[model samples]
Target: MKLSLKKIELTPPQILVIGFAAIILAGSALLSLPIASATGKPLSFLNAFFTATSATCVTGLVVVDTGTSFTLFGQIVIILLIQVGGLGFMTMGTLFAFALKKRISLRERLVLQEAMNQGSMEGIVRLIRKVIQYSLTIEAAGALIFSIRWSFDLGQAKGIYYGIWHAVSFFNNAGFDLFGPVTGKFSSLTAYADDPVINIVSMGLIILGGLGFVVISDLLDYRKSRRRLSLHSKVVLSATGILIAVGAVVIFVFEFTNAKTLGTLSWQGKIWAALFQSVTPRTAGANTIDLAGMRQATQFFMILLMFIGASPGSTGGGIKTTTFTTLIGAMIAMIRGKEDIVLFHFRLGKDRILKAITLTMIALFLVIFVAMVLSTTEEHPFLMILFEVTSAFGTVGLTMGLTTDLTDFGKIMIALMMFAGRLGPMTLAYALGPKTEKELYRYPEGKITIG
Candidate 1:
């Protein structure tokens, strides 16, 4: 048989995979340039590749110091990658299309539809516009506040630049920071642990960015509907509120007497630090205190929080808040022996519940597999390995001094984990191979299970 010139069509997942890979490659190439480094020397291939992947994936697990290693040119490249990764290239394309007054075809709409995790193609163009506008508005406000504080420290021009960089970093939930101290390396926000402005602005940006665009749009539309909100909006808001509050309390209780972490702080400072750490680990990677100084129990709990991560369709990575919430609802329904799963007085769909469970299981399997791999490859404590693996899988970027010490293969393992985590476990699974066939035939059901 002779083949004609037929156009090849790619599935949404395939398109997404290709797009992300292309971005990562381009970023790596750019960062490999000598001008990207402050030392006027190009980064090692592996280091550049890892940084590029992390930035493009919006995962901030950098092998090098983001501040001193890279020059202003390199920093700009990283910031651009973060913005594109956080909002997605599809949104960027849509914006460009809008600017050029070009007509968006069905194919473009379909891609945007998948990118936004929307139910349909309606209003997607408009939605992207709103997302850009809203995100910039928030970043501008946050940048202004940060600039005021940093201006006093870094001087006028440098301060504004630093402020913009961090504003973009936090808003994207990318953990990369330029605050590596002259004396203390990779200090993060520890120097300003007692500073209210830095803590509040950073945490607030992370929370808002992690809320997901759909939730933001829902709330914006709520007033028109007599203050009514969608079930998703309500669930996300409730879960986020509960998690932040409970996490703060747990961290405070666990680290209350730990001198290295919280004991040295005054009462108000301790409370603020606890709250900041709690909120940061769930999604964002920035921390006001040294994570290694915290109690082991707090670190363990942080792994759980990191695994759950930010809300679905957000810049942040992990299994997502809704997935965790759905699992909880399912468990509650099972204990009650209810045939239908319910949350917020609405009946939960069976398909959604199955997706949640499957995603979580896949995520758990990935984390454990990586941890075991790291154990063999890295000569670190088992608990620390677990923490690093979970952190990479969640794209949370928080490390227990294990990031820089990873050997060659270990770095690759964590890099792959970060890529998978950024795309999400379920999404990565789907991209690997989605069940495309429909079964019209049904066989008799058989059940045999004992736990």
Candidate 2:
């Protein structure tokens, strides 16, 4: 008799999914420990799992108040999860590899390429190094600013701790806030709504995080290279600015007289609240206003923004800004009777257009299906269910007061949605499907009717 072992190979997408899931499970285990709870009792496994999933996915929807329910050790675990999730596990792996002076294998590079959503493996290592440098630099600056402002409000020790915690949270777009003791549990940034310093710094961190690291790298390199921005960067920047501006205006207009939200604020306060609210809805879940009190129309509009979400390779999620831009470009091209979709004088390939459509359609279906399920399983209103579903699918973390009241089933489903959204629907699909094989011949082209 002979003993034999078979080696198993995993695709990059499979590796990413498993990596995130493993981190989430480990985080859950740590959180479930007695020391992790504020009251010195182990948190429920379900609550811990949900919290871990939310943290690891960088989706901030919480069943337990993070600041009130968890101890310092727990919060540190959460912050670590957010950092890894925001940067992707591969990025952290690369950091460890660097610390040990170990070479990243070719297979690891391939996984990194997929994790970062890069077009090629070339310069992947360099990009990861730059990502580390840029992320730490930005977070440090934000933390310094926060500490300076908060030192007058709180003692020096508390200010520094709060600064580091929140700076990381905001920069990673994690939306996890420790304002529970100062304000109220689940209050998010509402206490700082009128504070110009808080509003500006928070929004800046969110915007930078949502812009995607690749775009940041490109912008940084532009000064040295003196070349035009890549089409992807151009589209991301344009879309982000336009969305923020439009979202701000719409929110200000709709909530201008809503007393529960913006009406009680001064003119300056109103502007700050409106701007911050607009920015946070796009995958940054920190809210300066009472989201549940916002006008239904405003909430629905935010749902759209949440769905469009942040750019690719960004800490934030959703179908991605590039996907949205590509779909819009394709629509415009079709309306103009053009043969190809063009942006910045560059024609997009058919594959790119098809991928965008597929991604958007899949995302739409996922949100809809989850919303339907939640609506049926929970006692919340349909709008609230839909909002939560979109938030989960977009990894946006915005909610209409439905998260804490969720049944266990709802929590699990939402957690799964968060996981799917973080890895991306396409990646999951690819990972589960059979390996790609080129067809010998193409099928005949067919035409379809249009509206």
Candidate 3:
């Protein structure tokens, strides 16, 4: 008798995402074991699950203090999850497949196309190869710089490890720190903020990682061949610059006299903190100040920054800077009664506009719905709940002190939000199954009176 088995195939994105979720869940379960904790006590299932999801999503909201709760092994697991999550499991899987000399199927290419948001698959394999190469090179450089700086403060071996871990965490925007109470101590980076080496290196890593691989690829290719940058790259870079500059100026001006966080800092420290705060909310969660102690205005500003996070196809999350920019352009065009939405001399198609609007609407609804649910369950103030929801949905992870107090249901809600934020609502919707095509019908174009 002969028996044959059938091969099961999944789109690259689906396999990558589902496989990562499985790995995270399993890792969380294993880490929940008694031996995984620094205190040798097993963590509750919910806490373990929450931590795992947060790490895998590269979101830093934690149910327990990472520094005190988990052992080094557990922390390593979390870091690994964050790194994988940040780079994306599909990219890594494709790289391994390529290394193994496995031929990528057409379906896999389509999945890859979706994953990278590429316009074509002609050079996707090469692109993935370059992405891996560039990511590792940059991350290694960041780790080395951090390691040298940390060596002066911490011992040699520990410093090297911390440097590598934090370099990955910060660049990936994972925001998981093992600095103990010092994580929240917020000395304005006074101890290391002015180190120049640490600040510059960390900021560089954050910016490069958040810039999106497509932009990096374009820049690299352009430098090699002296070509012009793509319109997408132009838009992304322009928007990013404006947001960073505006955010920094606003933060510096507002907190100059708060006396609690930025006010007490020296001029140099204040500028450094302001820059860090501004850049961080673009979805990188590293902080030079205590977030809990910030003024209400600063927090509100942060909420806005977090909502318009790093660029598309980047390690960070949120609606994306490009999406936000495109929407703003569309709005301006509409206000001027123009039919075309152009940016950087390139016209954005209606499909792109519709998609952007849909993404923003879905993201907003998710945040608001989760906030309402959490407010009811946790009894937190509306603003705090909204902040937490936005943080989770943006995968920004800069919480205003409500992460640990969430009930089981609330934790699950947040986990779902993080997953949605990272994978994207549209992608998740696609993965759930194909949508039904509209049957026969044409609706009349109707206009409604608006504000």
Candidate 4:
């Protein structure tokens, strides 16, 4: 008798996880090459892996100064990684599939659906094409604005190069910057803190890029379909606006007299810095103010914002605006003794609410657990350690100047956090969990008490 074997198959989520890991590893290998560094010295395995993780995750955390440490060639690689990471690997794969005129298989569409967090597999190819086209167009426009402003400052060729570099970085919400040397290494956008042109353009790109592609698609369909905003678009826009306003106000209130971050600035400069700081911390890692100088209250507030992060299907990471809003909806419904979680006069599915809860719980668990691990490895202030862990978990790269001092083990811990942050707590869970299960029997329900 002949023996029979079963074929192995990967779930969409598992494929996504594997795909991102594969890309990060490849990027790490390339970045570790001697030619990839400005000093002609290749980064050690840990550093290279950290940088690649930062780039591929679009988290903007760096072990080395991107500008002073990497050559133009290396910078290009980093930006390319950001581009791939920002748009997501599957989104790019679909675009390339279209470019090659290859038929997108059903499995490929399913992967794209999962990657994009879409409701269905329908029109995934077209959606990806739109995402790529819109992304490039927006990035090009941003680059042009930057280049025009810097043409005389840095000369045409170099200015254009710098402009394009930052445009990509800004749109991707990756805070890796070449805007250093004049001030301090890894100084970020502090040198141009008061430059309205740079600040406005970069912030605009960050906001637009952070807005989920679904929202963009819905907006574009408005004129053609004559339909109102999708529920998701409405929730994301409303929450994003409120969060930004609240964050700016809180930052302004806390740092008005700190004399380090928002203080001591010209009145106009203060407002701009405050607003920029408020916006950037929410998944955009660029900073015009010293985060370390801000009060604990302000930093803690920012940790909340970072934990909420960008909306789903956007370049930036976090539990997501939808998840946050859903939790609130669930709470409100419970308080009112309502059976359904209603939002904007729409009843959300129980499954979605449960998922939101699950993601949040897992995220909190990861943050607390990792922070504890970090506390053991380093002798930093507890709040600072918590801040760093939350930042990594949110994929927001703002640090309290503690990233460079981390031990090897600490670096690994943060890297893991960044990876988990980018993939998402639930994504990691599902990706690593069993691929399939059959539940043919039901068990008696048990009630649990809650405060």
State each model's CA lDDT, in order. Answer: 0.88, 0.93, 0.83, 0.88
User: Distance (Å) between predicted and true CA of 65, model 1?
Assistant: 0.5
In model 4, where do residues sit more than 4 Å from their true spots?
A: 1-6
**Model 4, span 7-55: residue lDDT tens:** 8798888998899899999999999999998889888978989998988
Question: TM-score, each model?
Answer: 0.97, 0.99, 0.93, 0.97
Error of 3 at 63 (Å): 1.4
Q: Candidate 1, residues 122-181: lDDT per residue as tens digits? A: 988888888998899999999999999999998989889889999999999988899875
Cα displacement (Å) at residue 118, model 1 = 2.1
Go through the candidates in order and give the clash count of each. Answer: 0, 0, 1, 0
Candidate 1: the clashing residue pairs are: none
Most accurate candidate by lDDT: 2
Candidate structures ordered by lDDT, highest first: 2, 4, 1, 3
Distance from true position, residue 116, model 4, in Å? 0.5
TM-score of 1: 0.97
Q: For candidate 3, give the lDDT of residue 168.
A: 90
lDDT of 2 by residue, 1-451 (tens): 9999899999999999999999999999999999999999899999999999999999899998998999999999999999999999999999999999999999999999999998899999999999999999999999999998888887898899999999998888889988898789999988888999989998999999999998999999997868768888999999999999999999999999999999999999999998998898778889998899998999999999999999999999999989989988988988999999989999999999999999999999999999998888999889999999899888888888999999999999999999999999999999988999989998899999979
Tell me the lDDT of candidate 2: 0.93
- In what order do the candidates fall by TM-score, top score first? 2, 1, 4, 3
Task: Quantify how close model 2 is to the true structure by its C-alpha RMSD in Å.
Answer: 0.9
